[model samples]
Target: MRESTTLLRSPSNLASSQRLLFNSKLILPSPVPFKPKHMPCKVFCSQTSESSSTQTLKLISTLRAIPDWADGIKERGMKKKKSLYNHEKWLQHRSSLRHVRHLLSSLSSRVILSLIPPVIFFTSVAAVVAAYNSAISMNWLPEFFPLLRASSLPYQLTAPALALLLVFRTEASFARFEEGRKAWMKVVSGAEEFARQVMANVDGSSNVALKKALLQYIMAFPVALKCHVIYGSDIRNDLKDLLKQDDLSIILSSKHHPRCMIEFISQSIRLLLLEESKRTALESKISCFHEGIGICEQLMGIPIPLSYTRLTSRFLVLWHLTLPIILWDDCNWIVVPATFISAASLFCIEEVGVLIEEPFPMLALDELCNLVHDSIQEAIAMEHLIHDQLLTKRKNHSNEHLTNGRPTS
Candidate 1:
């Protein structure tokens, strides 16, 4: 067997080769094929060099379609191309009345739909009871029925209890939701402040890579924190392009990706800080990240007590079931829509609390992450630009010194 050794030596080889060699596996024994010992002994190629070249070109073109920043991050931001209009912009476009109309038209039907299930359940019970009562009144069923004669005392007593239970449930959940929001706000605020400090205080003129790494880690913190709170570990797709392979691998392997990112950031910051004690202010800001993550973890782990939740649910079901009994006698077949409106309102409140309690996905976390990312990118870019300008100035100064026959530092 004649073994052919060919090295596709280029920066674009990994991407093009992966696409070209995916379906085909060729086995040819080579003692040492590439620099990596793990490299496959078999080399697979597309039919011809021309096909590989064509596929490579196509891949490059496809890659070019993606807008990646110089720091290897793609700005994942609002996809909508339409410009957002504030009240001022709206006034310029149309009259104040029209602007007011547009503002008022922002109601979401999806929110209404979300509250329908519980409303429908309660309404069905009301309808069924109302229908039964009508049948009894019209001689379809005996008026002396045991259930019909059953006292409404129990239902009356428990109604207030159920109301109180739901109120407490909603209030508690909303508190957690509010706390989660505040915690995340700290994360965003800390990330921005930290990025600004690192860019402004840390001298990047001597080492741009260190400054860039610090900013990248700061941006990655919130994203990692989000994934952690949500119990998701698939951060490679989010941070893969933003960081080097080693840093990315460490993040993937760590149990807490956010903490890992923080450690990396702290290490980078420490290296930049000549006197550790002098960086106490920046260190405190970094600590805010840990505090935010801790708060989120508390919210995620410690929910409203399960027994309390179960009791509330049971009370709600029982109360709604008997509500039709009391209302049937008074309303006489006009209870369905009434029950629907009441139940819809109550259930909507409950659902809203539950949805916002975790507050990870609902709080526009992606938008916040993107915002932090953009700010960090801007800060780093500014630092790099300034560093480049300083370098150019120093070079010109050195050249002048040489021309004038003076010793240059």
Candidate 2:
């Protein structure tokens, strides 16, 4: 009774959910179809009809038609670079000066742009202080400028503290980045494994529609999750071709699309014409999806402690603000360029820290989602070919036995 009611829910993501990480189902079994001649597969077996062939071809084309997330999706953040995983290629990228376009369009530019205001402010302070010292010495003007500098003793004493703050801030953000990567890896692997199980276990003509729909949900899960973790993403556009209109509406209308997709998977497993033990085994794979959602939420909902971030920022400003005074005794006017170099270099580290803190933007979620979709489709496309190859081997084995007048046991 409860399982039947799941379909009637207006949106699978209930209007209210108290299970917050942040700030932020069963179906009836269908009747088993009777066995028929030429059952090539115990699971997903069909009569090899023209309609089935056409359906298979249609599925392949539909998968191919879905656009890749790696191309032209820069608004969501992150561009795909093949060399990120290739050490040799990355070295070449680093050594080559020809990638002027890369320098202009990369996340590097965004970080530099963000640093502009602070870098200018601190460098100007250095310039003004240097000029004031000159003006007072030459009697050209009175000391009207603000006293922006302090003794260098504080910078010397707190230098270790600043180092520690920067180190901790960057380390914490990178850890979150690594955590997100691993969580999605689980999701990808889970999707692949679950699809393989469905393709190999769920059998017959009666459940053909169910089998196809189940694969569609498996493919849709990662895309839903990709949208869920990142801001400004619409799941409908991504899933429109992959899922049926009704199912897509139900999932997209839900408050949490990724969780809604998981519910769809659970209900599909329940509806499978499988024994209790088999269904339970299949249902267990949903944990991977859950784990991914939880980890992504944890990273998105909770950031590195605010105290750490604020402390680092304030320390940098104060240190650079007073930096010229400390060097005024020796470096004098040279403090202008020195202050610029220090501010630009140090602030860049913090900017990069902030960039990767959210994790999702830095991640290639689009490509990862597309990989899951492509893998499931690729496996299914090869199914009949694998079966036919096995059939040919079996035929040859039987003929050899007949010729030798023995089974060769």
Q: Considering every candidate listed, which one attains the maximal TM-score?
A: 2
Candidate 2 Cα lDDT to native: 0.80
- Where model 2 places Cα greater than 4 Å from the true spot, the runs are 1-108, 142-151, 399-409
Which pairs of residues have clashing backbones in candidate 1? none
The residue-by-residue lDDT of candidate 2 on 1-409, one tens digit each, is 7765775453643443322322341244556776743365633444456669999998986654423222224333343321124687667667766487666675545566566667778899999899988777676776674433456787778889887888888888899889988998899999999999888888846688888988999999999988888777777898998998999989868999989998988988888898788788789988888988999898999998898889889889888988999888778799999999999989889977887898887877787888888889899989978888999999999998798996566
Per-residue lDDT over 174-277 for candidate 1, one digit per residue giving the tens place of the 0 to 100 score:
88878988998899998999888776666656647887888888888998887676544367887776788999999989887888898998888777744565
Global lDDT of each model?
0.72, 0.80
Candidate 1 worst ten-residue window by lDDT: 70-79
Name the best candidate (by lDDT). 2
Off by over 4 Å in 1: 1-111, 142-144, 147-161, 231-234, 270-273, 278-282, 384-409
Q: How close is every model to the real structure, measured as TM-score?
A: 0.64, 0.73
Provide the RMSD of all predictions against the true structure, rounded to 1 decimal.
25.5, 31.0
